[model samples]
Target: MRVALCQIEVGDDPKENLQRMIDALRGAPEADLAVFPEASMVRFGNRLADVAEPLDGPFVTALRKAAREHHTAVIAGVFEPAGDRVHNTVVGIEATGEISGSYRKIHLFDAFSDRESEDVAPGAEPVVLDLAGTHIGVITCYDVRFPELARALVDRGAEILAVPAAWAQGVFKEEHWTTLVRARAIENTTWVIAVDKAPDRSRPPRGAPGGVGRSQLIDPMGTVVADLGPFPAVRVAELDLGVTERVRSILPSLTHRRPELF
Candidate 1:
């Protein structure tokens, strides 16, 4: 299947971000699925409650319309407001304008004294949905660092893993991001498609200068099939799920694992 990864700069305006994503989708031909970055509806790291929207809000409605018009499945992130609490959530929209499922971010980003847990409630479940004949698992931002979440999805019959992140700029996070994504693909023997936000200067002190963009598509063998560098653009790649079977048949790593000892 062909996948489109959007790497765009998010700003303070949620409407502008949503419009940009829609415009980006127009440039690509019909794809089986399209993935956008975490908090695609609003700028990231500006406090969860400030940008939270309800599940039936205009942002989600726009996504559903876009999916139906383009005849493609979409997985995009938005800050979800439920009563008094908010959660970092990714919503899945089918081609028929149906709301398939949603995955709230389980692993909140709390590094470097930034306490996300204060505002956003952690998700209790890992979401896996079927998209165009492929079973895809959905995860947001910091959730990529947790291997158990990815493993659980894989065990539940996920052939592809999608991660949408608004990764901060600091230290060696760029290197770690790529390494961890590739590792997840290799270990699970599944395709990994990670879309990240580009750094913006207008946001705040929390918004640093560099995220490197570095959006990538990794094959089951941990090799990068396609990469979009530190710039704003759309990346498209064709991934064959058959590769998973080929890699597993040769190594048989999953079947040979001794989980009882570990």
Candidate 2:
């Protein structure tokens, strides 16, 4: 499948942000799927309570329209209302403009100098959406730090991992981001499609830049197939799923696991 990774700059306006993503999709290479960064609907670091919307709300509705117009499957980060706190979510829409599914970010960004737990609720399940002849798993930004979650998705028959993140910028943070992304792909023997948003100057955290926007795609062997630098950009690449089967056949890590001992 051909995938387009969007490294976009977002702002406070939901309408404008949606348009930005649609524009990127329109200009992308003929692709089966188009992926956007985390918080694609609205700007990140905003008050979750004020911006949180439901699955049928305007944000997702607009995304569905874009998917139908482009005739490509779309996936991106979103915020959904869940009780008192919002759920950091990733919603998938098929080329037919139908809601595929949603993944609520299981790991909240409660680390470093930020506390996402204060505004967002943690999810209990992993979401896998079948599209373009492959099972694509979903996870949000901070969850990339955990390997167990990626393994769970692989166990559920995921050939690729989809990550939508607004990765915060900090000391050694970029190093950590790239390392974890490659590690997950290598261990799982699956392709990784990671899209990150550009730095938001209006919403700096701890007196520093908001996010590091280095969107990239990694193959099963931990080789980067495409990388979009820390800026507003979009890149497309054709992925061969046969490579995943070949890598897994050699390593056989999943079958070699001695679950009883662990």
lDDT of 1 by residue, 140-241 (tens): 878999999999999999899999988877788888899889999989888999999876655454434434588999999999998898888887789898
lDDT of 2 by residue, 1-262 (tens): 8899988997777888888988998988498999998888766566777888998998899889889988889998888998889998898889999998889889988777778898889899998898766799987889999899999999898889998888888899888888888898998889999888987767532233556887889999999999888779988898899998899889888888888998
Model 2's number of clashes is 0
- In model 1, which regions exceed 4 Å deviation? 205-210
Q: Quantify all predictions' global Cα lDDT against the true fold.
A: 0.84, 0.86
Model 2 error, position 81 (Å): 1.1
